[model samples]
Target: MYRYDEFDQQFVSARVEQFSDQVRRRLSGELSEDQFKPLRLMNGVYLQLHAYMLRIAVPYGTLNTRQLRKLAHLARTYDRGYGHFTTRQNLQFNWPSLEQIPDMLRELAEVQMHCIQTSGNCIRNVTADHFAGAAADEIVDPRPYAEILRQWSSLHPEFSFLPRKFKIAVSGAAHDRAAVRIHDIGLQVVKNDEGQIGFTVFVGGGLGRTPFIAWTLRDYLPEADLLTYCEAILRVYNLYGRRDNKYKARIKILMHEAGLDTVRAQVEEEFERIRGGVLTLPEGDVARIRAYFAPPAFESLPAVSLVETQTAARDPGFAAWVATNTHAHKVPGYVSVTISLKPVGGIPGDASAEQMEAVADLADAHAFGEVRVSHQQNLILPHVKRDDLPAVYRGLVAAGLATANAGLVTDIICCPGLDYCSLANARSIPVSQRISERLGDPARQAEIGPLLIKMSGCINACGHHHVGHIGILGVDRKGEEFYQITLGGSADEVSAIGDITGRGFSSAEVVDAIDTIVNTYIAHRASPDETFLAAYRRLGMQPFKEALYGNA
Candidate 1:
């Protein structure tokens, strides 16, 4: 976790003061909704379908126990009893009163958190892999670079008002867990043959009315040149990205019009001029930032052999959770555990106030007081000893935080659609809940195997439906809710945008449609060994389409 420095502290505090004044003005009627819109957006407050939704950034999704506890407090005291974790790994409160927002901001600043850049047409939260510093295959921690970018871009003069919101993601591991390819600007940390750290930069990747996987702009950019290179890309987007039409204003639209080669050429030209400019990071700045994120001291312990066997034998629920939620750790005898927010029939990324507090307590008790909010909308205790698994599982189960589904069908990633978002055409959370209820059986899910089922309110792809093996996009059909399904999408090493399988399914029929697809895969797969994604890739959408439509 990157600790807030003096500059960060001052910036957030000052912004809170400013927003407080703005909120007063709005409440006093000096500022109308039109007049106050931009100010509220800059602070990450939105007037949603039913109420005002406040989105607070959890930069790169890393939080300490203290931070987690603070979030819990906010959910309990200020708004509803729950907070929704977003696909970007931030948290959103669905029903905050307009006047209470400033107070909330002040409270968040106390814990070194803020809602800045969680919304607006600027560089939003710079996301990274959830296993950033702890991944076994990582070459280096990506958080320092993310933090550096955060400082440089926060309220940047030119970028503060862009044609549309821009997103950036970075990854240090060989596997792209951060979904770097789906962001507007993606960076993969790499080392050259000379052992010098740098980045593999990608541009024009985004999902909305248009979807694109980023094109690699540069293979090996020196670490010192990161800011300079990133500046070049943003400068290009800001100068020429469409602004006349909000729907077609993202960098993806520009990439479509200008073509990838021309856009790359423009960015490269800008990079050449700014390579050694003031924006270039100071020597060893990365190391200095990294000091704040140094890994917690871990203990040397042998693997808990008896504990593992006993857990599998004694508690089938714990065994199921371990199978899906526990991940490989860099350290021996330590496992990273995902605390699933998507319990059967619950909101996909929501954590109740009590659940948040319980997670914080568990993190402090068994995982060295650190926690991570994953891009998949789950929480991670990144360094738990294998011996402590049962105890942690028991605690999580007691708190209603233990669900065995991590990457399963029921573990769906969905945005707060029509229920909360002003831009949505349909309600995503309810749709997700219905799907979970329909397929709530653990044995059924295990039979289905590993699958990524993602849902988005619209083409904006907030829930990243573009990369889901079974992607569901909600749309408006003459005042009725309809969902468009896509198949064969993936967000791994071999990333691909899902192709639409057929016409949209009615809201009532969507869940059963998905069940049909899953059952079809199970019945027709070469073997149970083949996962949903594997079978989809090998057999393509033909069989699944046949299974769904059934020869008209």
Candidate 2:
């Protein structure tokens, strides 16, 4: 994790003081709701359906035990005892009072975290692969670059207010776990033939009412020009992106209206103007940032843990958990463990304060005192020793954080729908919960193989439903909640928006529809080895649609 310097500390402290006064004015009636709207948004405060929502940035999804403990304290003391981890790899406190937000901000500042640029139509939190430095197949750690972007873009005068909110994701691994293809700007770290590191830049990728996979802007952008290239793209978007309609203000919409060639030409022109300028990243700076993210001290041990093997032989529960929750690590004797927040029949990403504290304690004790928030709404101990798997699993089980459902049907990605978001058309959490419960069986999930089910309450696509293997979108149809299902959506390296399976289903019929779809996949797949996504891609929507509508 990148520790904040003097400048960062001072900047955050000053912002807290500034927002404190703004909040005070609003509470004192000196500032009306209309006047405070932008101010509140700039500080990551949203007036939700029931209460104020505060989104705190977890840069590139990285956190240390101290920071995690602070979040748990905030959730316990300020909010209703739980916090919602979002698809952006951020955390939201749903019940924080407006008056108490400044205090919360102050606490976060102490831990080098803040809410700035979290809500506004600016460059939001820069995301990266959750397993960045520890991934077995990473070309490089993308978090250093993400941290650099954060430092550069925070309160940037040029991009302070864009046509719409922009999101950027970086992936160092070939697997594309960061979902780079679905971001406003996606950077995939690549090595050239000469073994020099650079990025494969993609632009115009986003999901909403209109979804798009980002077009490749540059097949290879030099590592030194990362900032300059990104700035050039932003400049192009800012100058030409639509400002008339909020619906079409995103860069993705601009890419749609203006052809990719034209946009690329414009970006190239801008890059020519700004290349090798002040924004050009220096080797020293890159090295400095990289040092902050150096790999932890790892001991030499066998690749396979005999203790873990023996324990799993005895305990089928642990065996299942190891299969689903643990990921391969770059280091031989270590693995990344995903502590699932999505228990069957529970909310997808909501973690109680106690759970947060428990995770913090476990990270401190077993892992490297570090935790990562996955975009899939799960917490990861990114460098856990294979030898300590049993003890960690036991601790997680005790804390009720031991749900072995990572990348499974029950491990859903969902937004705070009609329950919390005023923009939502129908409830999302309930639908997600119902689906999870329906497919809660471990054996069933194992049989289904790796599947991602993402749900959004509305077209805002906050839940990233557009990229799920089974994407569920909730809509209000004649005062009744209905869901539109999309199949074959994926957020991996070969990213594609899901295809809608004909008509929307009533809330009552949606879960059954999902079950029908799953059963159809099971029956149609060549073998159990074929994943739901692979089967859907091979078979297409006709079979699932026929199964759902039944030859209507």
Candidate 3:
């Protein structure tokens, strides 16, 4: 994690003081609600349907043990006893009092975390792969670049008030775990033939009322010109993106109207003008940012461990958990452990204050004190020793984080729909909870195999439903809760947005509809080995649609 320097410290402290004064003015009647609206939003505060919601940024989804502990403290002392980890790798507190937010911000600042740019029509948190540095397939860690973008875009004068919110994601692994295609800007770090690292930049990719898969703007953007090229894309969008209608203000609409070629051409023209200006990322500056993300030391050990194999044989529960929750690490004798937030009927990403604290302690004790928040709404101890698996699992089980449902059906990614978001038309969390309860059996989920089921409350696509293998989007019809299902969507190297199966289903019918789709795939798949995505790709959505709608 990057430690805050004096400038960074001063900037955050000043912002906190400013926001505190603004809140005081609002309370004292010196500033009306209308006047306080923008000020509150700029500080990541939202007046939700029920209460004030504050989103706190977790930069590039990386945090140290101390930071995790601070989040736990916030949850315990300030708002409710839990925090909702969002799809963008940030956390949201649903019930923060308006007056206490500044104190909360100060607490966050102590740990080098803040809510700046977490919301409100500006560049939001930049997400990267959870396994950025530790993934076996990574060419380079994407966090340094993400941090650079964070610094450059924070309180940027020209882009402080865009037409709508902007999101950017980065991924270094061949697998697109970051869902880069569904963001305003997606940067995939790739190595050229000569082994020099660069980015493959994608633009106009977003999910909302209008979902668009981003188009590759450049095949290879040099490391030095990342900010310059990014500035060009934003300049193009800022100048021409629709602003008359809030729904169409996103760059996706601009891409739809201007055509990708025309937009790319304009961006290219702008890039040439600013390639060597203030936006140019200098070599030493890059080095300075990279220094903050240095890799942890690992001890060499033999590949196959008899103790681990024996432990697996002794306890089927631990074995299953190890099989699902643990991932391959770049180093030998170390495994990446995913602490699942989705246990059985629990909320998808709600971690209690105690759970957060336990995760921090586990990270410190077993994994070099580094923690990562996954885009899938889980926490990762990226470098746990294989020998510490049982102890870690015990700790996680006690904390309700030891769900062996990673990549399984119950490991749902959901947005805080009507429950917390004012813009939501339907409730997303309850639907997710219902589906999860219906599919609560761990054995059943394991047998069902690998699946990515994502839910968004509305077309805003905060839950990233468009990219889930089975996507669920909540909608409202005549003031009733309804759900629209999309199938075969993937967010990987071969990413494709899922297609709507047919008519919407009522809230009660939605879970059964999902079950029908899964059962249909199970019955009609080519072999037992064929995954849901594979079978869907082979046969298309008609069979599943027919099964769900029943000969409509």
Candidate 4:
């Protein structure tokens, strides 16, 4: 909900003008792809398999209905009629022509949005919990600090180009919905003995060819020193991180080569030097940013809504949707609703322009004009009053956005694989679709309970397959597509990278293999109460392995 200031407005307008001229030159042959690649990347434009893909930042996953409407407009006017919401909480347009990118950016700028810092070697968009302000269990809203980091990292002269791209996530909730542990830097909101707020900082976590859970950089960092400490960590990564090999350039690799203690010592030394410098955030600045994200003026209400109860009693479908898609809210009578983009057998996160527009209207009507994009490739009505959920459900049903499977087996997280990404070794979306169709039954999905299936086209882990309970990575085998499976990984407070299964399955066999694994879990699990992750962890990989490959 942060509004752009005059300075912010001027800055974005200037960036647009700069990029427009750059595009003009590229079109005129003054700049070749070799010369223009970095420039386009800086603005979040990628020359993918078939066309230019534009990724627009959704800072901390927060958006107003107006901003979402603008995104819908872009989807309709500039590119294909649908856009994909990605795991990084950004939106990607896969079919935009090179010529229209500047115009698309200008349109985004009109709505106080931009693609800046969404890509490239500089720090990318700072992500936070989608339900930052609305979650019942949050310690404090993380968006203010996320916005601060965004402001500091955006075109920072010191970090315009680094050894590798950096990503940071902040989680206000103890549940770690932001997947903080797998980011380059992760900040978890915590309180000390005296109930003073601070952050538990984690550094050097990432997923690619190699995946790591970040090390504890600071057990507790005072709120005032957030920026200073962050700079210290980035300084270490920037200075010592490898540049000779792109694969080894990430901070995770640096952490791997240099022990955690040594990295901590270096960061501490740097922190001491800059502790009281200009980067030290003042109470006033934090307060000013927080004002932009202050909780909406919620009306006092009872703990539960009789209207919702009555509506659910009348419609089992609505009841099922409510059970699967809504989460507890801090405010009584309100629940954060996850609008499942991973509809049964459809592309995971693709939303039509009409669907986006419909969601915008629903958010305005039911969620106080606020919406959120989740890292799981879902949309959120973060402050939906329980009283309005039935009407919201009706709107979604009409828009073909109603899917009663938010955390269920069918809610798969997938990337735009070989279908669009040039780096992809195999197609991912079709594999994901086939898996979804195989497990699309609402009753079956409900029986499975809280399964996370993530698929990546390649090892870049764009779809976050490394952290999934059931991870699928598509790979090229000789001349055909094969999928490698992994189990028991999670992206939560207790995060772990998945262990790969024995072998890869052909595209045709992958879905049936998934079915075999699910059936194995079902048969071996102690109870339905034991989730897929819990069962996988408890039984280890032996049972699942036996199911996937028949015992000799």
Candidate 5:
């Protein structure tokens, strides 16, 4: 994890002071709601349906146990006992009072965390794979690069007010866990023909009203020119991206209208102008950043833990948890454990203050005092020793953070819809809750295999319904909630937008429809080993549609 330097510390301290005064003015009526809107938004405060929601950036989804404990304290002191982890790998205090926000910001600043750049029409939090440094399949760790971009883009003069909000996500592994293709800017670590490390840059991918898979702007961007090339893309977008229509303001719409070649040519021209300039990252600077992210010390141990194997062999519950919730680590004796926030019928990413503190404690005891937030709304202990799996599981179970379902059907990604979001046309949480309850059994989910059921309250795609294996979109029809289903979507290396199934289901019929879809896939899949995504892609949407609407 990258720690703030003296300059970084001073910068945050100044911003917190500025925002604190701004908040005071707003509360005292010196600033009206209309006058305070931009100020509050700039500070990451959103006036949601019921109350204010403060989104705090979790840079590259990495936090030390101390930072996590501080957040737990803030959640306990202010708000209503819980914080919601968002699809951006950020945390949102959904019920924070406007008056309490300044103190909250001050508290966050104490731990090198802040709500800066979390909202408004500028660069948002730069996210990377949650398993960045630890994943066995990763080519390189992308967080250091992400941090570099953060340093360059934070409070940059030019991009302060783009056509709309911008999001950048980085993925270092071959598997694309960061949903790279669906961000305003996506960077994938790649090795060139010369065996030199670089990036494969994608531009204009986003998932709002008009979802788009980013175009390959540069197949191989040299590591040194990262900032320069990135500046070129931003310059082109800022120069021509729409400002008239809010709906068409995103870079994705620009990519759709301008075409990839046109944008690429413009970006290349800009890059040529800026290359070898101040923006080019020096080798020493790169090395320094890389050194900051060096892996923690590990004891020399065998690949398999004998105690772990024996315990799992005895306890079916432990075996199930181990089977689903743990991932292979780069280090032989360690594993990355996923603490699923999705309980049987709980809100997808809502973690209570107590739960956060417990996870912080677990990270201190087992992991390297580090906690990670996954884009899929789960918390990750990125470096847990395999030998300590049972004790970790027990601790998680005690804290109500143990849900055993990671990639299974019940491990759903859902947005807070009509319940909290003002933009929602329908309720997403209760619907997902019902679906979870319907398929909550561990055996049933295990049988179903890896399934991603994402639900969005609207077309904003906050739940990433665009790329879900079983995608559900809620729409308002004649003052009633109707859910639309999309099939065969995935957010992996072979990213694909889900195809819509005809018509919509009533809220009452939605869960049953999902069951129908799942059962249809199970019946038609070639083997138990075949995943829901594979089955859907193999059989196409015909069988699933027939099952949902009936052949008649």
Candidate 6:
């Protein structure tokens, strides 16, 4: 993880005091609610339907044990006993009091964390692959670039107040775990024919009322020009992106309205103007940032762990967990573990303070004192020794975090809908909970194979429902909660928005509808090995549509 320097410490400390004064002014009636709105948003505070929500950025989803422990402390002291991990790999406290937020910010600052740029129409947290350095197929770790962007964009005067909020994601692996295609700016690390590293740049990708898979802006962007190219894109968006209506303010909308060719021309022109300027990343600076993310000291061991094999043979539960939750690592005898937050019938991403502390302890003991927050609302121990699998599994089981449901139907990505967000039309968490319960059986999940079910409360698409294998959107129909389903959505390398399956269903009918879809896939799939996504793509939506609505 990148340690905060003295400058970072001083900057965060100053911002804490600055925001503390603002909060005090609001409480003292010196600032009215309308006046405090923008100020609070700039600091990552939101006045939700029930209470104030605080979103703390976990840059590139990296966290050390110290930071994790600090978050646990915040969850225990400041807000409710639990905190919500979001789709952006950030953490949210939904019930924090307005006055206590300053204290929370101070606590976060102590751990080199903050909520800046978490909200508002600015470049939000720069995200990367959760398994960046450890992934077996990574061309390079993307976190260093993400950190560089963070340093460059924080409080940037030129791009601070864009037409709308912008998000950027980077993926280093050939397999797109970062969902880069659905970001405002997506950078996929690629190696040229000469073996020089660079990026395949994609722009205008986003999800909301309107969704788009980012168009390719550059086939190969030199590694040195990363910052310059990003700046050029932002400049183009800032100048011409829609500002009159919030609905059409995103860069994706600009791409839709202005056409990709025109936008490409404009970006190319801006790139030429600023290509060799101060924003150009230097080799020395890149090396310096890259050093901060060097691999941990790993010992030589057998490629396969006999201890893990023996333990799994003894414990079927551990065996099932290993099958579902672990990923192949770059280093032999090691694996990345996904700690599923979506336990059957529980809230998707809610982790209690005690669970947070337990994970911190596990990271210290099993991992290299490091933790990663996955965009799928899961925690990841990115480098765990295969030999220590049993102990790690035991700790997770004790903490109730051992739900062997990674990438399964039960591993749902859902947002806090009407329960927390004022903008929500209907409840999302309840629907997710019901679906999880319906498909909670481990055997059933294994049979269904890899499937992603994402739900959003409204069109804001906070839950990333647009990219799920099965997407659920909650809508308010005549004062009653109704749910709509979209099939064949995917967030991987071949990203696509889902297709709606005819009319909406009542809340009571939504879970059954999902069950029907799953059963239809099971029956129609050529074999058990065929994934829900692959089968859906092969068979198309007609079969599922017919199963759901029966030929109109």
Q: What lDDT does each candidate get?
A: 0.89, 0.95, 0.90, 0.94, 0.93, 0.95
Clashing pairs in 2: none
lDDT of 1 by residue, 158-242 (tens): 8999999999998988898999988888999999999989999888888777888888888889999889899999999999988
What is the C-alpha lDDT profile of model 2 across 220-300, one tens digit per residue? 999999999999999999999999999899999888889899999999999999887899888999999999998888999
User: Over 4 Å off in model 5, which ranges?
Assistant: none
lDDT of 1: 0.89
In model 5, the Cα lDDT at residue 124 comes to 95
> What lDDT does candidate 2 reach at residue 430?
94
Measured with C-alpha atoms, the lDDT of residue 109 in candidate 3 is 84
What are the per-residue Cα lDDT tens digits for candidate 6 across 259-309? Answer: 999999999999999889998889999999999999999888788999999
Error of 5 at 361 (Å): 0.8
lDDT of 4 by residue, 441-525 (tens): 8889888999999999999999999999999998998989999999989999999999998899998899999999999999999
Model 3 agreement with the true structure over 1-552: per-residue lDDT tens digits: 788999999999899999999999998999999999999999999999999999999989999999999999999999889999988899999999999999999998888889988888899999999988898888899999999999989999989999999999999887888888887899999988998889999888888788889888899999999999999899899899888999999998898888889999999999998878887888999999999999887878766667778888998989999999998888888889999998877788999999999999999999999999999999999998888888898899888788899999999999989988888989998888888888878777876899999999988888989988999999999999999999988887788899999999999899899999989989999887899999999999888877877787
Q: Whole-model lDDT for model 6 versus the true structure?
A: 0.95
Q: What lDDT would candidate 4 get against the real structure?
A: 0.94
Error of 4 at 272 (Å): 0.3
TM-score for candidate 3, please give it. 0.98
- Prediction 2 TM-score vs. true: 0.99
